[model samples]
Target: MEKPKILVTGATGSTGAPSVEMLLQRGHPVRALVHKEDVRSTRLKNLGAEIIVGDMQNMDDVRAAWKGVKRGYFCYPLNPDLLDVTVIFAQAAKEAGAEFIVNMSQKQVAATAKSPATIRHFLSEEVFRWSGIPTTHLRPTFFSEWFLYIAHQIKAGKLQMPFPEDARHAPVAGEDLARTIASILAEPGPHINRAYQLFGPELLSYAEIGEVFSQTLNKDIIYEQNSVQSMADSMGLGGSDHFKDHLANVISDDLFGTPDMNDVIEKITGKGPMTLAEFIDKNRTAFTT
Candidate 1:
Protein backbone atom coordinates (compact mmCIF):
# COMPACT_ATOMS: atom_id res chain seq x y z
CA MET A 1 0.00 0.00 0.00
CA GLU A 2 1.20 3.48 -0.84
CA LYS A 3 1.58 5.58 2.29
CA PRO A 4 -0.34 8.81 2.27
CA LYS A 5 1.64 12.04 2.07
CA ILE A 6 1.73 13.77 5.47
CA LEU A 7 1.80 17.50 6.26
CA VAL A 8 3.60 18.86 9.32
CA THR A 9 3.16 22.46 10.49
CA GLY A 10 5.72 24.40 12.57
CA ALA A 11 8.25 22.26 10.73
CA THR A 12 11.20 24.26 12.09
CA GLY A 13 10.25 23.85 15.73
CA SER A 14 11.16 21.41 18.47
CA THR A 15 8.55 18.74 17.72
CA GLY A 16 7.34 19.38 14.20
CA ALA A 17 10.81 19.21 12.61
CA PRO A 18 11.54 15.84 14.19
CA SER A 19 8.11 14.54 13.28
CA VAL A 20 8.85 15.29 9.64
CA GLU A 21 12.15 13.41 9.73
CA MET A 22 10.70 10.38 11.48
CA LEU A 23 7.74 10.19 9.11
CA LEU A 24 10.11 10.29 6.15
CA GLN A 25 12.32 7.68 7.80
CA ARG A 26 9.28 5.43 8.21
CA GLY A 27 8.88 5.37 4.42
CA HIS A 28 6.02 7.84 4.28
CA PRO A 29 6.02 10.89 2.04
CA VAL A 30 6.28 14.13 4.04
CA ARG A 31 5.53 17.80 3.35
CA ALA A 32 7.03 20.26 5.83
CA LEU A 33 5.42 23.69 6.28
CA VAL A 34 8.08 26.08 7.49
CA HIS A 35 7.95 29.82 8.08
CA LYS A 36 10.92 30.42 5.78
CA GLU A 37 13.42 28.61 3.57
CA ASP A 38 16.24 28.71 6.09
CA VAL A 39 19.05 26.37 7.02
CA ARG A 40 16.71 24.14 8.99
CA SER A 41 14.33 23.80 6.07
CA THR A 42 17.32 23.19 3.86
CA ARG A 43 18.37 20.33 6.15
CA LEU A 44 14.86 18.85 6.05
CA LYS A 45 14.85 19.25 2.28
CA ASN A 46 18.17 17.48 2.22
CA LEU A 47 16.49 14.67 4.13
CA GLY A 48 13.96 14.39 1.24
CA ALA A 49 10.83 16.11 2.59
CA GLU A 50 8.96 18.40 0.23
CA ILE A 51 9.29 21.82 1.88
CA ILE A 52 6.55 24.44 1.74
CA VAL A 53 7.31 27.89 3.10
CA GLY A 54 4.28 29.65 4.56
CA ASP A 55 2.54 30.92 7.66
CA MET A 56 0.01 28.73 9.45
CA GLN A 57 -2.21 31.74 10.14
CA ASN A 58 -2.71 32.39 6.44
CA MET A 59 -5.61 30.45 4.93
CA ASP A 60 -4.16 30.26 1.44
CA ASP A 61 -0.77 29.09 2.63
CA VAL A 62 -2.30 26.37 4.82
CA ARG A 63 -4.55 25.34 1.95
CA ALA A 64 -1.55 25.14 -0.34
CA ALA A 65 0.42 23.10 2.20
CA TRP A 66 -2.50 20.72 2.71
CA LYS A 67 -2.90 20.15 -0.98
CA GLY A 68 -2.78 16.40 -1.65
CA VAL A 69 -1.87 15.64 1.97
CA LYS A 70 -4.00 13.02 3.66
CA ARG A 71 -2.52 13.01 7.15
CA GLY A 72 -1.06 15.89 9.18
CA TYR A 73 0.58 16.95 12.42
CA PHE A 74 -0.24 20.41 13.84
CA CYS A 75 1.87 22.21 16.47
CA TYR A 76 1.86 25.92 17.27
CA PRO A 77 4.27 27.81 19.49
CA LEU A 78 3.76 29.84 22.70
CA ASN A 79 1.88 32.77 21.32
CA PRO A 80 -1.54 34.37 21.57
CA ASP A 81 -2.71 33.34 18.12
CA LEU A 82 -3.32 29.64 18.69
CA LEU A 83 -7.12 29.72 18.42
CA ASP A 84 -7.00 31.86 15.31
CA VAL A 85 -4.43 29.55 13.75
CA THR A 86 -6.47 26.51 14.69
CA VAL A 87 -9.56 27.92 13.03
CA ILE A 88 -7.62 28.50 9.85
CA PHE A 89 -5.84 25.13 9.90
CA ALA A 90 -9.00 23.15 10.66
CA GLN A 91 -10.91 24.78 7.83
CA ALA A 92 -8.02 24.11 5.47
CA ALA A 93 -7.88 20.47 6.54
CA LYS A 94 -11.58 20.06 5.93
CA GLU A 95 -11.25 21.59 2.49
CA ALA A 96 -8.34 19.28 1.73
CA GLY A 97 -10.31 16.14 2.58
CA ALA A 98 -7.76 15.15 5.16
CA GLU A 99 -7.98 11.60 6.45
CA PHE A 100 -6.34 12.24 9.84
CA ILE A 101 -4.63 15.06 11.76
CA VAL A 102 -2.83 15.02 15.11
CA ASN A 103 -2.89 18.06 17.41
CA MET A 104 -0.32 18.89 20.08
CA SER A 105 -1.88 19.91 23.40
CA GLN A 106 -0.57 20.31 26.91
CA LYS A 107 -1.75 18.15 29.79
CA GLN A 108 -4.33 19.47 32.31
CA VAL A 109 -5.94 21.76 29.81
CA ALA A 110 -9.42 22.66 30.99
CA ALA A 111 -11.99 25.16 29.81
CA THR A 112 -12.50 26.36 33.37
CA ALA A 113 -8.86 27.26 33.79
CA LYS A 114 -7.95 30.89 34.35
CA SER A 115 -5.49 30.99 31.51
CA PRO A 116 -7.01 32.31 28.31
CA ALA A 117 -4.37 30.29 26.54
CA THR A 118 -5.59 27.15 28.23
CA ILE A 119 -9.12 27.92 27.17
CA ARG A 120 -7.80 28.57 23.70
CA HIS A 121 -6.16 25.17 23.73
CA PHE A 122 -9.45 23.52 24.70
CA LEU A 123 -11.25 25.45 21.98
CA SER A 124 -8.62 24.47 19.44
CA GLU A 125 -9.20 20.79 20.20
CA GLU A 126 -12.91 21.30 19.68
CA VAL A 127 -12.30 23.17 16.43
CA PHE A 128 -10.86 20.02 14.88
CA ARG A 129 -13.39 17.73 16.52
CA TRP A 130 -16.18 20.01 15.35
CA SER A 131 -14.67 20.18 11.89
CA GLY A 132 -15.64 16.52 11.64
CA ILE A 133 -12.05 15.59 10.87
CA PRO A 134 -10.50 12.37 12.07
CA THR A 135 -8.21 13.92 14.64
CA THR A 136 -6.08 12.71 17.54
CA HIS A 137 -5.16 15.00 20.45
CA LEU A 138 -1.98 14.36 22.40
CA ARG A 139 -1.83 16.02 25.85
CA PRO A 140 1.78 15.78 26.93
CA THR A 141 3.42 16.79 30.19
CA PHE A 142 6.22 19.35 30.54
CA PHE A 143 9.10 19.02 28.16
CA SER A 144 12.56 18.24 29.46
CA GLU A 145 13.78 20.81 26.96
CA TRP A 146 12.38 23.43 29.32
CA PHE A 147 15.60 23.03 31.25
CA LEU A 148 17.32 24.86 28.45
CA TYR A 149 15.24 27.88 29.34
CA ILE A 150 17.36 28.19 32.48
CA ALA A 151 20.60 26.91 31.04
CA HIS A 152 22.52 29.57 32.92
CA GLN A 153 21.09 28.41 36.20
CA ILE A 154 21.77 24.78 35.38
CA LYS A 155 25.31 25.63 34.30
CA ALA A 156 25.77 27.17 37.72
CA GLY A 157 24.66 23.84 39.29
CA LYS A 158 21.14 24.77 40.41
CA LEU A 159 17.69 23.66 39.42
CA GLN A 160 15.09 26.32 40.05
CA MET A 161 11.52 25.59 41.00
CA PRO A 162 8.37 27.70 40.94
CA PHE A 163 6.05 25.25 42.64
CA PRO A 164 5.34 23.94 46.06
CA GLU A 165 7.61 21.30 47.55
CA ASP A 166 5.00 18.58 47.07
CA ALA A 167 4.53 19.19 43.39
CA ARG A 168 6.06 16.64 41.01
CA HIS A 169 5.79 15.62 37.38
CA ALA A 170 7.41 13.46 34.72
CA PRO A 171 8.92 15.86 32.19
CA VAL A 172 8.58 14.46 28.70
CA ALA A 173 10.98 15.05 25.82
CA GLY A 174 9.61 16.72 22.68
CA GLU A 175 11.52 14.29 20.43
CA ASP A 176 9.73 11.38 22.09
CA LEU A 177 6.41 13.12 21.53
CA ALA A 178 7.38 13.65 17.89
CA ARG A 179 8.10 9.95 17.53
CA THR A 180 4.64 9.17 18.85
CA ILE A 181 3.18 11.64 16.36
CA ALA A 182 5.05 9.85 13.57
CA SER A 183 3.79 6.48 14.78
CA ILE A 184 0.22 7.72 14.68
CA LEU A 185 0.61 9.30 11.24
CA ALA A 186 2.34 6.18 9.97
CA GLU A 187 -0.77 4.24 10.99
CA PRO A 188 -3.80 6.39 11.83
CA GLY A 189 -6.42 3.67 11.88
CA PRO A 190 -6.51 2.91 15.61
CA HIS A 191 -6.07 6.51 16.79
CA ILE A 192 -8.95 8.22 15.01
CA ASN A 193 -10.66 10.70 17.33
CA ARG A 194 -8.60 9.47 20.27
CA ALA A 195 -6.87 11.57 22.93
CA TYR A 196 -3.72 10.25 24.56
CA GLN A 197 -2.00 11.50 27.74
CA LEU A 198 1.74 11.30 27.13
CA PHE A 199 4.44 11.41 29.77
CA GLY A 200 7.91 10.15 30.61
CA PRO A 201 9.11 6.94 32.32
CA GLU A 202 9.32 8.39 35.83
CA LEU A 203 8.12 11.29 37.97
CA LEU A 204 10.41 13.59 39.92
CA SER A 205 10.31 16.86 41.79
CA TYR A 206 12.62 19.79 41.07
CA ALA A 207 14.94 18.70 43.87
CA GLU A 208 15.16 15.19 42.53
CA ILE A 209 15.69 16.51 39.04
CA GLY A 210 18.58 18.52 40.44
CA GLU A 211 19.98 15.35 41.94
CA VAL A 212 19.83 13.67 38.54
CA PHE A 213 21.73 16.62 37.11
CA SER A 214 24.34 16.37 39.84
CA GLN A 215 24.82 12.66 39.25
CA THR A 216 24.88 12.90 35.48
CA LEU A 217 27.14 15.94 35.34
CA ASN A 218 29.14 15.00 38.43
CA LYS A 219 28.66 18.43 40.04
CA ASP A 220 27.23 19.63 43.31
CA ILE A 221 23.72 20.84 42.55
CA ILE A 222 21.02 22.59 44.56
CA TYR A 223 17.36 23.53 44.04
CA GLU A 224 15.82 26.81 45.05
CA GLN A 225 12.08 27.37 45.21
CA ASN A 226 11.41 30.68 43.49
CA SER A 227 8.42 32.90 43.06
CA VAL A 228 6.52 32.35 39.87
CA GLN A 229 7.37 35.79 38.48
CA SER A 230 11.03 35.39 39.30
CA MET A 231 11.15 31.97 37.74
CA ALA A 232 9.28 33.15 34.67
CA ASP A 233 11.58 36.15 34.25
CA SER A 234 14.63 33.98 34.68
CA MET A 235 13.40 31.62 31.97
CA GLY A 236 12.44 34.53 29.67
CA LEU A 237 8.77 33.55 29.82
CA GLY A 238 7.68 36.87 31.29
CA GLY A 239 8.08 39.16 28.31
CA SER A 240 4.37 39.78 27.77
CA ASP A 241 1.53 40.29 30.23
CA HIS A 242 -0.88 38.03 28.35
CA PHE A 243 1.63 35.23 28.15
CA LYS A 244 2.46 35.74 31.80
CA ASP A 245 -1.18 35.25 32.73
CA HIS A 246 -1.12 31.98 30.88
CA LEU A 247 2.15 31.07 32.51
CA ALA A 248 0.81 31.89 35.93
CA ASN A 249 -2.27 29.76 35.50
CA VAL A 250 -0.20 26.98 34.05
CA ILE A 251 1.99 27.07 37.12
CA SER A 252 -1.11 26.78 39.26
CA ASP A 253 -2.28 23.94 37.03
CA ASP A 254 1.02 22.13 37.44
CA LEU A 255 0.82 22.38 41.21
CA PHE A 256 -1.96 19.84 41.09
CA GLY A 257 -0.79 17.94 38.03
CA THR A 258 -0.82 14.15 37.93
CA PRO A 259 2.55 12.79 38.91
CA ASP A 260 2.97 9.40 37.26
CA MET A 261 4.59 7.53 34.39
CA ASN A 262 3.09 6.17 31.21
CA ASP A 263 4.29 4.03 28.31
CA VAL A 264 2.61 5.92 25.49
CA ILE A 265 5.85 6.45 23.59
CA GLU A 266 7.03 2.88 24.10
CA LYS A 267 3.70 1.48 22.99
CA ILE A 268 3.49 3.67 19.92
CA THR A 269 7.16 3.88 18.87
CA GLY A 270 8.42 0.58 20.32
CA LYS A 271 11.00 2.45 22.41
CA GLY A 272 10.91 4.06 25.82
CA PRO A 273 11.51 7.79 26.09
CA MET A 274 14.74 9.20 27.46
CA THR A 275 15.14 10.37 31.05
CA LEU A 276 16.32 13.83 32.12
CA ALA A 277 19.82 12.57 32.86
CA GLU A 278 20.18 10.83 29.52
CA PHE A 279 18.76 13.85 27.69
CA ILE A 280 21.19 16.16 29.50
CA ASP A 281 24.12 13.90 28.65
CA LYS A 282 23.14 13.75 24.99
CA ASN A 283 22.80 17.54 24.78
CA ARG A 284 25.58 18.14 27.22
CA THR A 285 26.93 21.28 25.59
CA ALA A 286 23.59 23.05 25.83
CA PHE A 287 23.68 22.55 29.59
CA THR A 288 27.41 23.27 29.90
CA THR A 289 27.12 26.97 29.12
Candidate 2:
Protein backbone atom coordinates (compact mmCIF):
# COMPACT_ATOMS: atom_id res chain seq x y z
CA MET A 1 0.00 0.00 0.00
CA GLU A 2 1.29 3.47 -0.85
CA LYS A 3 1.47 5.56 2.28
CA PRO A 4 -0.10 9.01 2.47
CA LYS A 5 2.23 11.99 2.48
CA ILE A 6 2.36 14.00 5.71
CA LEU A 7 2.03 17.77 5.39
CA VAL A 8 4.02 19.83 7.88
CA THR A 9 2.90 23.42 8.31
CA GLY A 10 5.38 25.92 9.78
CA ALA A 11 8.02 23.69 8.22
CA THR A 12 10.79 26.24 8.80
CA GLY A 13 9.90 26.97 12.40
CA SER A 14 11.55 25.72 15.58
CA THR A 15 9.23 22.72 16.02
CA GLY A 16 8.34 22.14 12.38
CA ALA A 17 11.95 21.78 11.24
CA PRO A 18 12.64 19.01 13.70
CA SER A 19 9.32 17.30 12.96
CA VAL A 20 10.07 17.35 9.24
CA GLU A 21 13.50 15.88 9.89
CA MET A 22 12.03 13.15 12.05
CA LEU A 23 9.34 12.19 9.53
CA LEU A 24 11.90 12.01 6.73
CA GLN A 25 14.22 9.97 8.94
CA ARG A 26 11.35 7.53 9.48
CA GLY A 27 11.01 7.14 5.71
CA HIS A 28 7.66 8.91 5.55
CA PRO A 29 6.94 10.99 2.45
CA VAL A 30 6.44 14.60 3.60
CA ARG A 31 5.05 17.76 2.02
CA ALA A 32 6.52 20.80 3.79
CA LEU A 33 4.30 23.91 3.76
CA VAL A 34 6.48 26.97 4.03
CA HIS A 35 5.49 30.62 3.75
CA LYS A 36 8.32 31.37 1.34
CA GLU A 37 11.12 29.75 -0.58
CA ASP A 38 14.14 30.58 1.52
CA VAL A 39 17.24 29.00 3.01
CA ARG A 40 15.08 27.09 5.49
CA SER A 41 12.85 25.71 2.76
CA THR A 42 15.95 24.79 0.77
CA ARG A 43 17.28 22.90 3.78
CA LEU A 44 14.02 20.97 4.10
CA LYS A 45 14.20 20.08 0.41
CA ASN A 46 17.74 18.85 0.96
CA LEU A 47 16.36 16.70 3.77
CA GLY A 48 14.02 14.95 1.28
CA ALA A 49 10.81 16.90 1.86
CA GLU A 50 8.57 18.23 -0.91
CA ILE A 51 8.36 21.97 -0.27
CA ILE A 52 5.13 23.89 -1.06
CA VAL A 53 5.10 27.64 -0.67
CA GLY A 54 1.88 29.12 0.71
CA ASP A 55 0.55 31.47 3.35
CA MET A 56 -1.57 29.98 6.11
CA GLN A 57 -4.04 32.84 5.84
CA ASN A 58 -4.75 32.25 2.17
CA MET A 59 -7.40 29.56 1.75
CA ASP A 60 -6.27 28.68 -1.75
CA ASP A 61 -2.68 28.21 -0.60
CA VAL A 62 -3.77 26.12 2.36
CA ARG A 63 -6.03 23.97 0.18
CA ALA A 64 -3.21 23.41 -2.24
CA ALA A 65 -0.95 22.28 0.58
CA TRP A 66 -3.59 20.04 2.11
CA LYS A 67 -4.34 18.20 -1.11
CA GLY A 68 -3.67 14.44 -0.96
CA VAL A 69 -2.25 14.64 2.61
CA LYS A 70 -3.87 12.56 5.33
CA ARG A 71 -1.73 13.60 8.30
CA GLY A 72 -0.43 17.11 9.02
CA TYR A 73 1.08 19.38 11.61
CA PHE A 74 -0.81 22.66 12.19
CA CYS A 75 1.12 25.66 13.46
CA TYR A 76 0.71 29.38 12.89
CA PRO A 77 2.51 32.54 13.90
CA LEU A 78 1.38 34.41 17.01
CA ASN A 79 -0.37 37.13 15.10
CA PRO A 80 -3.71 38.88 15.56
CA ASP A 81 -5.18 36.78 12.74
CA LEU A 82 -4.13 33.46 14.28
CA LEU A 83 -7.71 32.34 14.80
CA ASP A 84 -8.67 33.14 11.24
CA VAL A 85 -5.65 31.22 9.99
CA THR A 86 -6.68 28.20 12.06
CA VAL A 87 -10.19 28.43 10.63
CA ILE A 88 -8.74 28.42 7.13
CA PHE A 89 -6.58 25.42 8.01
CA ALA A 90 -9.41 23.50 9.65
CA GLN A 91 -11.78 24.13 6.76
CA ALA A 92 -9.13 23.11 4.25
CA ALA A 93 -8.17 20.03 6.21
CA LYS A 94 -11.82 18.99 6.36
CA GLU A 95 -12.18 19.45 2.63
CA ALA A 96 -9.09 17.34 2.07
CA GLY A 97 -10.39 14.63 4.43
CA ALA A 98 -7.22 14.73 6.50
CA GLU A 99 -6.99 11.77 8.88
CA PHE A 100 -4.99 13.34 11.68
CA ILE A 101 -3.79 16.83 12.71
CA VAL A 102 -1.43 17.87 15.46
CA ASN A 103 -2.17 21.39 16.64
CA MET A 104 0.51 23.52 18.34
CA SER A 105 -1.08 25.35 21.26
CA GLN A 106 0.02 26.92 24.54
CA LYS A 107 0.01 25.45 28.05
CA GLN A 108 -0.72 28.84 29.64
CA VAL A 109 -3.92 29.20 27.62
CA ALA A 110 -6.92 29.94 29.80
CA ALA A 111 -10.59 30.52 29.19
CA THR A 112 -10.55 33.75 31.17
CA ALA A 113 -7.15 35.15 30.20
CA LYS A 114 -7.04 38.78 29.05
CA SER A 115 -4.30 38.45 26.49
CA PRO A 116 -5.75 38.27 22.99
CA ALA A 117 -3.14 35.67 22.04
CA THR A 118 -4.10 33.43 24.93
CA ILE A 119 -7.79 33.79 24.24
CA ARG A 120 -7.24 32.99 20.57
CA HIS A 121 -5.21 29.90 21.44
CA PHE A 122 -7.89 28.74 23.87
CA LEU A 123 -10.54 29.08 21.20
CA SER A 124 -8.39 27.61 18.44
CA GLU A 125 -8.27 24.32 20.30
CA GLU A 126 -12.04 24.31 20.55
CA VAL A 127 -12.42 25.01 16.85
CA PHE A 128 -10.27 22.01 15.92
CA ARG A 129 -12.23 19.76 18.25
CA TRP A 130 -15.54 20.94 16.88
CA SER A 131 -14.31 20.43 13.35
CA GLY A 132 -14.73 16.65 13.94
CA ILE A 133 -11.29 16.02 12.54
CA PRO A 134 -9.24 13.45 14.42
CA THR A 135 -6.86 15.90 16.11
CA THR A 136 -4.28 16.00 18.91
CA HIS A 137 -3.42 19.25 20.65
CA LEU A 138 0.04 19.97 22.07
CA ARG A 139 -0.15 22.59 24.80
CA PRO A 140 3.43 23.38 25.63
CA THR A 141 4.45 25.79 28.35
CA PHE A 142 7.04 28.56 27.93
CA PHE A 143 9.46 27.20 25.37
CA SER A 144 13.14 27.13 26.29
CA GLU A 145 13.49 29.11 23.09
CA TRP A 146 12.23 32.08 25.12
CA PHE A 147 15.73 32.26 26.54
CA LEU A 148 16.52 34.06 23.34
CA TYR A 149 14.40 36.93 24.63
CA ILE A 150 17.18 37.55 27.12
CA ALA A 151 20.03 36.26 25.01
CA HIS A 152 21.32 39.82 24.79
CA GLN A 153 21.34 40.08 28.56
CA ILE A 154 23.03 36.71 28.88
CA LYS A 155 25.72 37.74 26.41
CA ALA A 156 26.22 40.84 28.56
CA GLY A 157 26.59 38.66 31.72
CA LYS A 158 23.31 39.89 33.14
CA LEU A 159 19.86 38.23 33.01
CA GLN A 160 16.83 40.46 32.82
CA MET A 161 13.18 39.29 32.55
CA PRO A 162 9.99 41.10 33.46
CA PHE A 163 8.61 38.25 35.58
CA PRO A 164 9.32 38.24 39.31
CA GLU A 165 11.99 35.97 40.74
CA ASP A 166 9.30 33.86 42.42
CA ALA A 167 7.22 33.42 39.28
CA ARG A 168 7.90 29.98 37.87
CA HIS A 169 6.85 27.74 34.94
CA ALA A 170 8.18 24.55 33.51
CA PRO A 171 9.65 25.51 30.17
CA VAL A 172 9.82 22.73 27.57
CA ALA A 173 12.53 22.34 24.94
CA GLY A 174 11.46 22.90 21.35
CA GLU A 175 13.30 19.83 20.15
CA ASP A 176 11.66 17.71 22.80
CA LEU A 177 8.26 19.02 21.81
CA ALA A 178 9.08 18.28 18.20
CA ARG A 179 10.03 14.73 19.09
CA THR A 180 6.66 14.29 20.79
CA ILE A 181 4.88 15.68 17.75
CA ALA A 182 6.82 13.39 15.43
CA SER A 183 6.04 10.37 17.56
CA ILE A 184 2.33 11.09 17.36
CA LEU A 185 2.51 11.66 13.61
CA ALA A 186 4.27 8.36 13.19
CA GLU A 187 1.49 6.53 15.03
CA PRO A 188 -1.65 8.65 15.35
CA GLY A 189 -3.89 5.87 16.62
CA PRO A 190 -2.78 6.16 20.23
CA HIS A 191 -2.99 9.95 20.42
CA ILE A 192 -6.19 10.66 18.51
CA ASN A 193 -8.42 13.31 20.08
CA ARG A 194 -6.00 13.82 22.97
CA ALA A 195 -4.56 17.06 24.32
CA TYR A 196 -1.15 16.83 25.98
CA GLN A 197 0.44 19.43 28.23
CA LEU A 198 4.14 19.17 27.51
CA PHE A 199 6.74 20.44 29.98
CA GLY A 200 10.41 19.99 30.83
CA PRO A 201 11.87 18.13 33.79
CA GLU A 202 11.81 21.05 36.25
CA LEU A 203 9.82 24.12 37.16
CA LEU A 204 12.13 27.12 37.16
CA SER A 205 11.90 30.76 38.10
CA TYR A 206 14.01 33.47 36.48
CA ALA A 207 16.41 33.36 39.44
CA GLU A 208 16.88 29.63 39.08
CA ILE A 209 17.36 30.05 35.35
CA GLY A 210 20.15 32.51 36.15
CA GLU A 211 21.79 29.87 38.32
CA VAL A 212 21.55 27.40 35.45
CA PHE A 213 23.18 29.94 33.13
CA SER A 214 25.94 30.73 35.61
CA GLN A 215 26.72 27.06 36.10
CA THR A 216 26.40 26.08 32.44
CA LEU A 217 28.39 28.98 31.00
CA ASN A 218 30.95 29.07 33.84
CA LYS A 219 30.34 32.82 34.06
CA ASP A 220 29.01 35.12 36.76
CA ILE A 221 25.55 35.61 35.32
CA ILE A 222 23.49 37.90 37.50
CA TYR A 223 19.72 38.16 37.59
CA GLU A 224 18.65 41.76 37.76
CA GLN A 225 15.16 42.54 39.03
CA ASN A 226 13.54 44.95 36.65
CA SER A 227 10.07 46.43 36.56
CA VAL A 228 7.79 45.63 33.63
CA GLN A 229 8.31 49.13 32.29
CA SER A 230 12.08 48.80 32.55
CA MET A 231 11.95 45.36 30.99
CA ALA A 232 9.89 46.72 28.09
CA ASP A 233 12.39 49.55 27.71
CA SER A 234 15.26 47.06 27.66
CA MET A 235 13.55 45.09 24.93
CA GLY A 236 12.91 48.32 22.88
CA LEU A 237 9.13 48.08 23.39
CA GLY A 238 8.74 50.97 25.81
CA GLY A 239 6.07 52.75 23.85
CA SER A 240 4.24 49.78 22.35
CA ASP A 241 0.70 49.56 23.68
CA HIS A 242 0.44 45.86 22.78
CA PHE A 243 3.46 44.92 24.86
CA LYS A 244 2.19 47.02 27.76
CA ASP A 245 -1.09 45.08 27.81
CA HIS A 246 0.78 41.76 27.59
CA LEU A 247 3.12 42.83 30.39
CA ALA A 248 0.10 43.78 32.44
CA ASN A 249 -1.37 40.30 31.90
CA VAL A 250 1.86 38.69 33.00
CA ILE A 251 2.02 40.81 36.10
CA SER A 252 -1.64 40.54 37.05
CA ASP A 253 -2.32 36.88 36.23
CA ASP A 254 -0.27 34.84 33.77
CA LEU A 255 3.26 34.56 35.21
CA PHE A 256 2.22 33.48 38.69
CA GLY A 257 0.12 30.52 37.56
CA THR A 258 1.83 27.13 37.95
CA PRO A 259 1.59 24.62 35.14
CA ASP A 260 0.77 20.98 35.73
CA MET A 261 3.75 18.72 35.14
CA ASN A 262 3.36 15.34 33.45
CA ASP A 263 5.30 12.44 31.98
CA VAL A 264 3.34 12.59 28.74
CA ILE A 265 6.47 13.21 26.69
CA GLU A 266 8.37 10.29 28.18
CA LYS A 267 5.29 8.09 28.02
CA ILE A 268 4.82 8.74 24.32
CA THR A 269 8.40 9.24 23.08
CA GLY A 270 9.96 6.65 25.43
CA LYS A 271 12.42 9.35 26.58
CA GLY A 272 12.42 11.75 29.49
CA PRO A 273 12.05 15.46 28.91
CA MET A 274 15.20 17.60 28.73
CA THR A 275 16.31 19.89 31.54
CA LEU A 276 17.07 23.62 31.54
CA ALA A 277 20.77 22.86 31.92
CA GLU A 278 20.56 20.46 28.98
CA PHE A 279 18.70 23.04 26.90
CA ILE A 280 21.36 25.68 27.64
CA ASP A 281 24.13 23.22 26.86
CA LYS A 282 22.54 22.28 23.56
CA ASN A 283 22.24 25.96 22.52
CA ARG A 284 25.31 27.23 24.35
CA THR A 285 26.51 29.22 21.35
CA ALA A 286 23.31 31.31 21.26
CA PHE A 287 23.69 32.34 24.90
CA THR A 288 27.42 32.97 24.57
CA THR A 289 26.96 35.09 21.48
lDDT of each: 0.86, 0.86
Clashing pairs in 1: none
Candidate 1 structure lDDT: 0.86
Which pairs clash (backbone N, Cα, C closer than 3 Å) in model 2?
A: none
lDDT of 1 by residue, 194-280 (tens): 988889887887778888889988898887888778877887776676667776787666524664667878988999999888888
Q: Among all windows of ten consecutive residues in candidate 2, which has the lowest summed lDDT?
A: 251-260
TM-score of candidate 1 versus the correct structure, residues matched by position: 0.95
For residues 1-289, write the lDDT of model 2, one tens digit per residue.
Answer: 6666899998998899999999898888999999899999999999999999988989999999999988999988666788999999999999999889999987767788787777788899999988999999998877898787668889889988767777778888888998999999999998999988888888877788889999999999978777778777877778866566666675444544655577889999999988999999998898887
122, model 1: CA deviation in Å?
0.7
Please list the residue runs of candidate 2 whose C-alpha ends up more than 4 Å from where it truly belongs after superposition: 229-244, 250-258
Superposed model 1: Cα runs more than 4 Å off? 254-256
